[model samples]
Target: MKKILTLVVLSFTLTMNAFAAQKLDVEVNGLVCDFCAQALEKVFGKKESVKEIDVNLTERYVRITLNEGKEIADEEVKKLIIDAGYDVVKINRVEE
Candidate 1:
């Protein structure tokens, strides 16, 4: 009985940790120029959880990766981009 209990506890702990390590992707809009891309980089760079930020000018999108288990809400991310003088038309999560 004790062994089974220990296994159950371990399993639960591992599952939680796995969920915490999840990552997400986001898409942005109104990034039609180089200056807009630079501005986005500056704003996202200030986020502690932002591990990487890739901007595609032609597509007018920004792909962002956050630290393991950390995530910035779509509204929050949009607000940040908008604050930098750009428009966020959409936000999408990249699936693994």
Candidate 2:
């Protein structure tokens, strides 16, 4: 009975953490080609907290999915893009 109880609590905790994960939508300038998208993907994918990255060149947007209990600041996002030779035009937190 104790083992079952512990398992139930652990399951609930994991579920809640998944629900608390963060997502970000960022519009960037100069994301004009597949190579540019690949560069952004490589940058964001290297972060341990980043679970997923999706870039749409047509829409000039980058969507980032972060693990639970982790976050990247707007300034940091801008800096990352800038360092990768792009400019961030807008950033917004995506509600889960």
Candidate 3:
């Protein structure tokens, strides 16, 4: 009975971790126009981890809300931006 109880608690913890929401803010360079923002939105929109994307051309930043339990590495974000023909100035986690 004790073993079963322990197993249940462990499973619950793991499941919660997997579904936790997260957000990231990335400052970028060369976001000069709405078209550029659209290009970036299109690129990030396809990512499974990305639940929402908000691009501010005037602020030169992209805010991404990650799906529950999904997280992205800084290097991967930088690479994705680079792949989309943009330059990443900085990337940081948005503390909840």
Candidate 2 per-residue lDDT over residues 1-96, each given as its tens digit: 999999999999888866696999999999889999999999998998889999998999999999877878998999999999999989999867
Candidate 3, poorest ten consecutive residues by summed lDDT: 14-23
For model 1, how does the per-residue alpha-carbon lDDT over 1-96 read when each residue is reduced to its tens digit?
A: 999999999999877875563344455656677888888888889998788888888766788877776777878887888789877776777633
Q: Which regions of candidate 2 fall more than 4 Å away from where they truly are?
A: 1-18
- Mind giving the per-residue lDDT tens digits that candidate 3 earns over 1-96? 999999999999888767777788899998998889999899999999899999988788999999887888999999999999999998888745
Please, what is the whole-model Cα lDDT of each candidate in the order they appear? 0.77, 0.91, 0.90
Number of colliding residue pairs in model 3: 1
Question: How well does each candidate superpose onto the true structure, as a TM-score?
Answer: 0.72, 0.79, 0.79
| lDDT accuracy of residue 84 in candidate 2 | 99
| lDDT of residue 62 for candidate 1 | 82
Local distance difference test, candidate 3: 0.90
True-structure Cα RMSD, model 2: 4.7
